[model samples]
Target: MPIEQGGRVSWGVDHLPYGVFSRPGQAPRVGVRYGDRVLDLAAALHDEVFAAPSLNPFMVRGRAAWQATRALLREKLTNDMAVTEAHLVPLEQVRLHLPFEVADYVDFYCSLDHASNIGRIFRPDAEPLLPNWRHLPVGYHGRSGTVVVSGTPITRPHGQLKAGVFGPCVKLDIEAELGFVVGTPSEMGAPAGAFEDHVFGVTLLNDWSARDIQAWEYVPLGPFLGKSFATSISPWITPLDALPRIPGPPQDPEPLDHLRRRADWGLDIVVEVAINGEVVSRPPYASMYWTPDQMLAHMTSNGASLRVGDLFASGTISGPRREERGSLIELTWNGNDPIKLADGQTRTFLEDGDTVTLRATAGSITLGEVSGTIR
Candidate 1:
């Protein structure tokens, strides 16, 4: 298959896509995400294990494996004879694993609206943004061990909740976010630009939070127990290249010297969250103040080392428009007013047995969705 001669066409599927595949009875092996289906690398090459020629050096290795896989699939798919009759599995039948194995996790607070909303709740007289808000992307190290696949069930995290000064606490909330999956590694102490070519895909993520715990311990440092209870990601990874290009320049204050990219960067993805079975908030990925490229470029500037599966989450995506808020907390104004669902139930936060699914569509030909039930 000759992919190089495919020309300078702008194809989203070609840019950033990966998946996991295997034959019936065999455990799923990694594959690349394609339109309406997956390109089974393991079966296409007919290898018992994941190793194959021109592919052996990259398979299951790291982002390099994904980079290699992308190159090969483009060749094979372009010619249309790489792997025949491999049983095109119904996309719904397959269980999704976290597209890449994450080595570390980082959650960033780059949304000014989220920052301002949370801040106004406490210090009404002071400004919402921190003094360092415009300097760089603010982030917190997260627990990688708790990162689960798309369909996994999430147990309500148990934590202390203090209601008032020396009062018993009780409240929990979930922060909806868009996650970034790396395709290449960056050496520590370098800059964010190093990750531009290293990034492979993006997915919807939910960063669960305990508002009660957060209100108490958040004085010097940011979230700890209030933040790290449980986190979820959609099963499929939408390649960055598959996303539609944004039309305008980056949000103002621009970015630090290290976090600059072309104006058209960032994928145009429509993101939404459904509670129980009703749709709540639908925020477009374009609403983000900072694009992933700026985020990556800023992250690496400190010379931080990243692994093949290191996940970077954009803190709750909120827009200037009221309906564009990504989380219920922001939408309801901290439960000042309750949102009425189609079923006549009210929700300030997700409840037991409540299921939340996050999904995004790049176009009719490409998309990814993930849902999980609360236990």
Candidate 2:
């Protein structure tokens, strides 16, 4: 059956993504969204293929299995092939949980526009970009243990800034990024092409920041306790195969053969950020300087290994326009200018009680909606 036959689900067929869900009395089970209900894949297939607490076991089966599951599920869903009412659960009645266990977390500064803007603001005296920025993807390892599923409240992190002043992160900011989930493990010496084979899907990630603590502690080492406090991600994982390809910009002074990804790494994901109920920014994912494949390639260039469920993030995807900025630091120019809100309020950074929502859409298929409130 064609996916087009299943009329307008919240995240329909093309988005045919997977996640973990639990009902009132049931334990977590892998499920797929179809129309306004969630189909219990395990129950529908009458097997334990999707019976795991997270989607890791199923996702680790590689792309062939992923396609098979999607095809079988799509047919059962679209044509009502073998699905029964018992296998379908109402979306509202079920609670969504973290879809995968993050074995490792890595984040990349892949957006040239975002990097350049931040560079000018923080290091105005010298050239905005470092010499090696364009040569390779700049990234740092992050705390995976603290990664929370969407809707989880982020506590205002407490830390020092300029010798114990303006603490509790007066500059509580949000970095809107698209994260890639690795389902297949890679060898230690794998090259950029390995990304195509290892990466499984994508998700919306919010790297909440404490700008003051980061400013004080970032030197010598990248980030520490400030960034480790909390990070939020969407519940659903959208497979890479479900999305269309939009190639990234050409690399000047071409990369080495090992780093060159001949295939399309760019994804035309439209990412939006909103405060309360008003939309603030809509940064285009295509504006990123480095692609996902390049980041994966560059990450392992030094003989590093890739693990299953390892999450890699594309940081703060800002665009050419002011309104396209992904972080509050760029949007409000480091609190000098406050952005006006819909409810007759203005904010330079997130305040307590403020709910921030990050959403990404690819055509009619929504990757996921990752939202959290500042506390």
Candidate 3:
């Protein structure tokens, strides 16, 4: 990929996101994504760390190593492209696998718009946000085993609709969100200013939800079967060094000292949601009420240790406008208002054959898209 005069491509060398790839007879190994190709990191760098099937080995090396490796990759890709060209593999000729092994999965309700919309839809007469919503980043533990790579087929999950009722999930939905990849592990205590140090990268995530099932079981505790069925994420993990940070949305009542923002970690990536090839929503990430740094601080404030490949996602990335809603439940107003597709078919939720794709971009650099079809 040729770097333009200003030094950026649609998917540029500056954004050399990493992932694991395999050819027909080869074992999976780490690679970096260039424009239309994957740079075999193991072959090009001659490092056995990149020869590992997952990114965990490289990620556990901590921040200093991470930064040094990134700098080296840029130098080689830009100035030494002629020598490194032989290791470049076309993206179409390889299979992309899950980039890292997930140690734990946590999803946060960080979007005020999504939370408010959902509250209004379900509790029309009550307050839109819960009492403790603004006070902290509300979240729930999710099943890490179910997390899968992009393009994996998602079977519609089944759960109890009411008491003693069980069947296929009729109100299947998608939550367009961004996931944070944890690199360095930390012992107990809060990581207030260590967001960039510990978080290695970001990835587009689609938290597939069963609205009816979620509504039924998420009363006292939180999500269970409705959410754990499947979660899809982009194959490429864009390093934090590549994303441009900006000021996040202002919090109404200031957060506590522990939850305070130490740095401008608010990412300005724009996320686009498409259903069956038609663009529907373009949810802005900058609009999220709670920043990832705060979420990290809150997660470890209670003596929770961070793991090498732990993944935490910013729950549905919805905006204030109707077109900016991230989930189908919010877009269609809990099935009361159905969205019309280009094919003239109105949809309240995902059908068995429908496909959902989420793409995101920060300025000129396009993040790898997470796409999945219902089976």
Candidate 4:
């Protein structure tokens, strides 16, 4: 697509997000979003930089390559004679695929609001923040195999539940998250500052959850079948360099040097949750208590090596208000309160035919959206 008269697209030249795409009867290829158009990267770059079905190869090429690629695209879009129009395709005409392969997935419970509210529900008489909660980025390894692209329908998962119950999960829910993708692998014992060199981009993630199964199974260990069924991600990944960080929340009992981040790692993105066609919540990404960089530092503090395409997600991002809660469990107070939908439908938990969409916007550009229908 021509870089428009005003030299800005909805995604804009500043945000040349990348994704894999294909049209009817065509092989999947790499494409970069420029405004409302998708530029076939293979054709525009005049090479096979993005020939593979996934973006792993391109992503793992390191920061220099990523910067060079973005620079080239920005220059081309800025100059009128830099490229031809034939290489661009209307975004609505093509299918966007998973931008990169996921090697490992970790979900962190770092949101003070989300955790505090949940703590009250599970342990009303106890302190909201558990011991050691503020000192570390508490998280768990998730099933990477079940991660899927946007638009993929998720079947409600069945698992052992509370009160000896076992069946399709009745309390199916969604967690709005900002997922960080690793581009450069880090050696064991890399500090949190390695974030500047290793982390690649960001994607909107929907961590599908089964609250009933989780409540029952979480006695000894954390999430398993309740969360492993599926995790959906947006098709495009906005490179880290493209986003300007905003100030993050201050940590009490300051973190150690390994978890320290001098720069503001928080994002000032507007997050919203839509059910069917109506927006139910507006969760702010800036409200997150733990930054992705801190999570990375903690994940590797144990000498765990990082790999390309590894995904680390900010667990359910809930804010201080009732409407901003990311899941029905908190919004409905564990199903005790029913929320009204746009169509005048009332629901405590997701019912069959319910569609939940998680979306975010950074300034005027969309960070991309992920949605899944309960089938």
Candidate 5:
């Protein structure tokens, strides 16, 4: 039977984001989102690569294969809709899993506004930015093992607080961000231009934070227990080819030769961060200071190898406006000012039952949303 198209589903032919999904009795397999359905790639294309539980096996096939598969998917879905309709599984009938097996996770602080906001709030008496802020894309290796799929419950972490006291996190927060999925592997180093060759797709990310814990421990080495507890990501990975890339924000001092991009890689993704059920912030990705390509180049400039399924994210995507703040610390000014919700409640930080969701769009393409409720 032909799939009925009635109501609006943001997912269309232009946005065939890939994910791993499974029916009740079936094992997880690769599928692509089409309208409100998931087209089983293994069944539709007769390829075992899609039979794998995660996207890693297919991603290892490299750029040419990725491009060819995308083209074939478009062809089958459009011209052969009658034959392909049989393989379409209703989105609700399947459970979405992490699209790929994450090999390594790196989160970069690439937003100028977000960085300045943090500096202003924490180091109010000092200059807003660190001296080395403009020199490079400051980042920290994140715990890949803790990266979870959307809808996963995020338990508030416990750690040492100010005055050497330890307790449950009081300042639970969410960082609305964009994550880049790596498909192709590289040896010693990859240049800025090689971002397209290595990256497979993009996904929405929520870097759950324990601000109180972070404030006490992140002085010399940066975040540990405060951030590594849980990082939620959207199940669908939107192909890089599907997004619209605009010119990135200009750099004050031109980047080093290795970090200089031959082409603009800045994404025009607009991200919305919601608390409980109310939309609180709408951070603009185009306003970010460092591009993903520059981040990759800088990451690999020191001879770090890129592995298939490696994930990297653009740190909080904030803008100049107060409403554009991506994290609770900045949005609330470190709990100085509370945000009033639609239900007549004010929140300085996340409560035990609070749910945070991060949704994004690039032009007409709706990237998958990452949501988690605090437990």
Candidate 6:
């Protein structure tokens, strides 16, 4: 049997979890992952056989429904239920939505490696990290209105691409990242919630990039069209409450007094990326220079209100290792050297028809996977 966290069962190999939207004739609006199948959450909820008083309150609301749904799944699997006559649905039948409507979106460049690689290329000999980097979580507000679920195709965007020698480019690229969704909202004046409550869940994120276009336009205010094109996320969201609460040590060199969080503020979720069905890059969530809680605290420090459904992506969590790099620009060193894949195709940046998938799993519990075909 799996262990429990905060009175809820910890997700494990025996139990798989998923999210769902209601439909007629569906067993219930819930999805359970047993091996390869995506069990319907809606079906489980309606069935009196799977009764749980704890999950009664969250049966309707989208976010709460998912949370309660997972909690019960863990219980059922751990206890080993005998109801084998489930409505068994195909994994493809699951209609994956945003999991929750996003109220806001924020992206942070918390990886010093990513910042340094780009900074060195742009401003050689300059300090790679900004002075405020260690003191706070640096971020840019994103377009929540544009976020989409996995399997969505993103068109190569058009924007300014300024290259001194080569003139400019219409090229595009992808950035691998771990996205955090806000579980609870903060009051107008009250301080941000502790690390435990601020972060609700984790998902794989693919932040598409138009490198050439970005280079030309990102002079004064950072990324614009180069980034705003389209961002994709995996369908299922793994609530933070479901994973093991094993806390990691504080980030290196210790954070500023105000930014420092409790010892267990961060999780060690693994993040990886694939291109054309090939695993090109893989890295642990621990590679992040900062934690999601710190980012939340910093965002709310100025009294900026945080609302539920807010999506905060820990900026390309790149590490010092070469294979751990997250973006094409960084991986290829700004196109100076292209990465050759086993598939006989070399990619300095993303190409037309290239499909990229971002997948993350902690132990046997997956946060699901997000994939997009570039056109």
By TM-score, the best candidate is 3
Candidates in order, TM-scores: namely: 0.83, 0.95, 0.97, 0.95, 0.97, 0.84
The lDDT for every candidate, in the order shown, is: 0.66, 0.86, 0.92, 0.87, 0.91, 0.69
Encode model 1's per-residue lDDT on 221-278: one tens digit a residue.
Answer: 8788777767888766765556677753355676655666655665676777788767
Error of 6 at 38 (Å): 2.6
Residue pairs in collision within model 3: none
Q: Ranking by lDDT, best first? A: 3, 5, 4, 2, 6, 1
265-311 per-residue lDDT for model 4 (tens digits): 89887789998968989988888889988998899887888888999
Worst 10 residues of 4 by lDDT: 1-10
Give the least accurate 10-residue stretch of model 1, judged by summed lDDT.
Answer: 1-10
Q: Model 6: residues >4 Å from true position, as ranges?
A: 1-15, 21-32, 47-70, 84-88, 163-169, 244-253
Give stretches of model 3 more than 4 Å off: 2-8, 189-193
Error of 1 at 15 (Å): 8.6
Clashing pairs in 5: none
Misplaced by over 4 Å in model 2 are: 1-10, 81-84, 189-193
**Per-residue C-alpha lDDT of model 3 across residues 178-249, encoded as one tens digit per residue:** 999999898866453489889999999999999889889987899999999999999999999999899888
Q: Supply every candidate's count of residue pairs whose N, Cα or C atoms clash at under 3 angstroms.
A: 18, 0, 0, 0, 0, 14
Task: Output the worst ten-in-a-row residue range by lDDT, candidate 6.
Answer: 51-60
Error of 1 at 162 (Å): 1.9
- The residue-by-residue lDDT of candidate 6 on 1-375, one tens digit each, is 334544543345433544543334443343545544555544555664222221222322345555565666667655645552264455555555556667788999888778888888778788877677767778998888778889888887765456543432456778888888776677787567675565666778888888887777777998887788798987666666666545544566687666777656556667778888888777666767777778877888777877767889988867788888888888888888888899788988887788998876665455678899977
> Global CA lDDT of candidate 1, please?
0.66
* RMSD, one per candidate, in order: 5.4, 2.3, 1.8, 2.2, 2.1, 5.5
